[model samples]
Target: MTTAFITHHDCGLHNMGPEHPESPIRLLAIQKVLQKTGLIEQLKQMESVHVTPEQIQLAHANLHQKRLEMKQPDEGVVYADEDTALCPDSLHAASLAAGSSILATNQVLSDKVDNAFCAVRPPGHHAEHNAAMGFCFYNNVAIGAMHALQQPNVNRVAVVDFDVHHCNGTVDIFKDKPEVLVCSTFQHPYYPERYCDIQRDNIVNCPIEAHTRASVFREQLEKYWLPAIQNHKPDIIFISAGFDAHHEDPMADLNLTEEDYRWATQLLMDAARTTCGGRIVSVLEGGYNPVSLAFSVQAHLEVMAGY
Candidate 1:
């Protein structure tokens, strides 16, 4: 079974600004590193499609999509909030980013692919049903998870997020849904600090602290994530994979490294193999620091490609 590499040039056009950590250069850096390191030879590369507004509405709201459609600027940049922004081409890139995951999910569910990675960005874990924040316009992972459940008769779906910042949008959108299970590990008392007390049973929030090392991250995976995944027995697995927790990233205080992402990928793949028909779809969420993001993404994709 081949692993799919889904991405597009449009993703690089959704630039936030020169100083923003979530810059368009982040995608360029990863693709360049992948090609330079010859990791592209190990996976099947495919072009991504633009997602429909209805599909975006599946994980978001009518007004949210409507507002985005109305607010799309035709010039330099359109600011949505403090962090998130919309370039003239941002809507195009964001559409393709979300669509890449949906296509990847279909490939995995149809048995055409074993696993897949989406190397597009302007990370989406922070976009909720009615709002866009944290440099995210649409909840890309949530759309992918919803696609998995709605298409191909997947009764249970699981989403795992390991961003240094909490995936508050993902949890908020999925907490009420019984068919979906969300497990997130983010820096406690970090950015977007609403998830201190989880209100749902299926939503597993592992809030770690500043300067946390790999051992602590892995321990939570064993104690919290693995147990919840074992009990849920998801039919398909989706990952909101974020590499900003790397020790080299300046965005947050976590001390994780590329090896930690590789290790977590192995564990998630193992769990997926056991109960989820070995189906996994991963979408990029957060990872700053171009060099560390490139290496960390390469490490994660190597594991996804069975390296």
Candidate 2:
């Protein structure tokens, strides 16, 4: 149950817009839930560092990196796409968001903690290696997975995503890299729809139709993700922990509850314990409904904390 809690205030400063579903309140809600549930006191809290450009290059192209920097607005917000934008401190916040993953990875792999949950923002998993969209600037989990691969005794790593939208960015980065396995479950015919059907051996995509319930989500994980992860035998596990699929969330049409998230975390913990020494780095991706997001995160972290 030794888990590190990594986050930063800058993550909250990456404001897209007041009406944006991926607002800073998402992080605030998660924090409130942790505090209210007394889970904050039970774990080690660490400030997230800024991710280096070189580390970011592991998953994103140099041009894309520089473009984000160049797009940083000095005053008002500037749009990366219709859905994503950069305010005055957006790049800094995004950097911290990406860095949270790196910090969590090092902590878990070094055994400083058995696992980590990074409650940061600017949800990644949608931004491609050369593009920034879907309220994502950098592929945070992908960068962390590449960082883990650089460490000695760390080769195979797995990135598991349960966001309502497909993690096209993560799969794009690791599709050809056999050492990194990307397993994602998302609602199909959804946002950033490309790459859901990409032909790759290392990428396992379980596209759940809209209105699917928790039972189906669980079944897919057991049938598709379990066998793939077991075969990959990852040295560490990274999760793009997005809860936008909740029935209460407006972002997608999946009928998952907080308990479903808890069950998924339990399954991953069991798999990690048997295969990767319980090394897991979970980075926040998407969850719009503040109340449900908070409760969902609470349930997820309880399992990560071995409660």
Candidate 3:
């Protein structure tokens, strides 16, 4: 199996503050770990390209990109929402973040790579179709899924999010579109609580309580997500891979170790082997603690790299 690692140096430029959990150090940590373990040399590393405005509109409102451009501060950071902020280089990095997903989709669909992992900042699962929040802007995975749907021989797609928080933005964009199947396992009564309870055949939401154990998380996915993916029979699979659910993470309460991440990645990989010919494009979402996040990502990539 061949895996592609897609990232951009500029993704580190969108710094909110030194105290902010979503600092550039997150990417630096992942890179450092990958290099230390010799995993970086095993994958096809590529720089991310900028996404066009037309592609950004695939999952966003027509004015969404323009509004963000308009709000960009010249000299200092400006808050788009209570949690999301924008500095001079924020949009530039965001454009690359969104673009990395598009490039990964293309690489996977073209059979150039069996799967791809996008390491990007300003994670996008919380960014709604009309708003940006939760340290996210421009719903990156959504843009990639939309792009994949437009490609030849691609009839349907599935998005699996294992983040501690629900993928409100991804659900918001594809809730009405039956061709896209979204399955998520998140902590109940969490942040950005929108579309969490909306009933849709395409959206399968498994809301686990805080402090949920890894075994229970696996059980929930096997019961809720596995069946959905089998029924959907997607042409491609996209993962909103978030490591914030790790037990060591300061962001949320979940007792998942790197081994759990490895187990989940293998579960999805097994599903992909049968359903989509092992085509998966995973985008980075929320993982705050640099040490735990790096190790967790290493586990996920190890499986993708055929270890």
Candidate 4:
């Protein structure tokens, strides 16, 4: 079967603001590039379902759900933090984004698809167990990881994040759970600088300095993520695929390229193939530059689609 491409229009309606880096245009750019590259039509496209409160509660505290609901604005934007915000439709959009992952997970686990990609967002890797921050409200990948574990024979899941900024929230959520292995790489001393120093066998964090290039990134992945993943041999693999580290991206100093995205996707795909029948679910996290984000996502998805 073909790879599943899961997304929703609601994701485009959750606008932070005109000036925000996590703009609605990010999704549009990805869609346009996928079409331009002829990759969109090669996959199995599906609309995202609205994520129920119960589904979110699997990864977050009840208080976090209530707070997000209470903070929803009817017209204008309400700030969850200096970086995070909610407009009238933000919650619905966020729900669909989270749901996209769950649906993609089901598709992959059920053998309906070779793998899956969730092209929805309000990127979720930074939202902690009970708090929303870092332009993320619900931890989508975390939710999907927990949801995947509910399946029979799925006792272990691996969450691999490459977002240029640490997935502090993912680490926070899964730190105590040995069943979930989180391998993340990000720039050190950067935004949301917490949990990077935590000592945990299941949580592997690689912190690179600014201006780090693809060669160093590849070396670090080999040194850190590969060994951890091989040992874990998770039942499935989830990727917090962020492209902000692209050399052309304005968000960070790490200099990666489209080829790097493809390389990482292939690397993880190989790991998935060996460990979990090639069941991989990748969720969008961060990639601000529209042009570069488009090309980078295209590169990532091409590999997921078996290019």
Candidate 5:
């Protein structure tokens, strides 16, 4: 399927603290597992380029980049919100994270790759249009979707987020834009609870309760998300792929295993093949437990890589 694996070493430089769950070790673990399983050799690996300020503005406020720049710490970490933090290299890594999505979109749309997986982080689903929170800075998937809308022959796009937390930032940016379909399955009454209840034809929000089982999650997606995607008929599909919903994850309560992730990826792949020529640009969001996260990502990639 020619799956592109996009990432940057500098993404590991944006460390908040050793105790922080969103540590660089997350990517390291994924890489180790991919290598150990010989799966890394099956994909097209590429380094991420930096996102331009103008491209960052595609889904952010004009002053957003400047404000983050002003707040960048010289040495110690600075808190952007109660949970999100910025170190000296945080923005640098964030720019790459956002940039990787852009590159992935380009690769998929150009037919150079059937799909791409962005493994960069300071995950962006909770970043919002103007504010940064939930360990996210710039909304990576949003920027990529916006970029795709500007491309030739790309009339519409769908963003499907399966994160434990709602994609408030992605919904915030595309809520009013009908051409962009935003679908999400998240735990109800969760963190950064904004735009979850906002009624929009383009947004299909399936808010599952905490401790939701795997079968139920799949049932919800089949009932809610499938109809929306079929109706939207997007030119491309973007996944805010978060594995934090895994049962072993310390972040949230959901009984999803790596097999669930594989099943979900396969479902999305089928949808993309039907509606978008199998063009998907998936960006990493939240997945805290290194072991579980790595295995989950492996399953997702295996499906995308046609393994």
Candidate 6:
């Protein structure tokens, strides 16, 4: 019945800007909500484990890593994109974000905890294998998913991404690979775009329009994501747990509410219960609009912890 929450203070320092939607406030909102609602007593908070270059190389190319390493600004802000920036501490924060997922994976796999959630920032779903954009430097959850799949004993792994923006990075890395099943639903015609043209049996990219509501989301979950996970029967389940799809988020037009997050997490949890002894490693990806993000994460974690 134990659940782990992985995070790092360094992740709080990677600021995109005051006006940027992906500001570091995303983490503060979640942490404050967990405290105010007394959810901290129900979950164990663990320090993020710093992932190495080799670990990040599992999901991203060495070239991508090298470019990010070289681009680290010594003082002022440098641009990864118009929206993404690197300040002096950006690399450290990004490293912690990626490492949080690795720690979450190891915690669940080693039986140190039953399930884990990473509440770090610099959301990573939009970064592709070699392209870092949409406020992501490295595909954190993808790195963790690859780590879990690369385990010498593991045979199958499934990744579920429910972000407002499609996880182009994750899809690009795992597409055409039989060992992994990546199911994602997002608001299309959005940032970084979807990887649908790269058609692969293992990837289920269900792009919903902006303001797509809860009932449609639930129906898609029942008809698409849940079935795919069941059929794949992954030895481990990895979630790119993003909340920007919430109705309150301004980043995208998705109208999903906290209840949607609750329902989705429950479905994933049920599938994990049936297939992997409830083994799920969820890492934070996207969620802005502080209030909505906080509420959505609360709902998601409540189900993951079986509350």
Q: How far is candidate 1 from the true structure (C-alpha RMSD, Å)?
A: 1.0
Model 6 agreement with the true structure over 1-307: per-residue lDDT tens digits: 7889888888989876687787878888888999999997899988886779999899888888789878888888899888789888887888889998888888888888889999987878778888888889989988988889877667899999998888888898888678899998888777776585568889988888876666888888899988898999898899999898888888888889898899899999999999888999998888888999998999998988879
> On residues 86-125, what C-alpha lDDT tens digit does candidate 5 reach at each position?
9999999999999999999999989999999999988999
Across residues 10-107, which tens digit of lDDT does each residue of candidate 2 receive? Answer: 78888877787788888888898889889999989999999999999989998888888898989989999999999999989989999999999989
lDDT of 4 by residue, 1-307 (tens): 4799999988999987899999999999999888987899999999999888988999999888888889898898999999998999898899999999999999998899999999998999999999999999999999999999999999999999999999999999999999999999898879889999999999998999998767999998889999899999999999999999998889888999999889989999988889988999999999999999999988888898887
Q: Report the lDDT tens digits of candidate 1 across residue range 28-74.
A: 89999999999998899998888888889889988897798688888
State, as a TM-score between 0 and 1, how close model 2 is to the true structure.
0.99
Instruction: Let me know the TM-score candidate 6 reaches against the reference structure.
Output: 0.97
Better of 1 and 4 by TM-score: 4
Off by over 4 Å in 5: none
What CA RMSD would candidate 3 show?
Answer: 0.6
Candidate 2 weakest lDDT stretch, 10 residues: 13-22
RMSD of each: 1.0, 0.8, 0.6, 0.8, 0.6, 1.2
Off by over 4 Å in 1: none
Misplaced by over 4 Å in model 6 are none
Tell me the spans in candidate 3 whose CA falls farther than 4 Å from its real position.
Answer: none
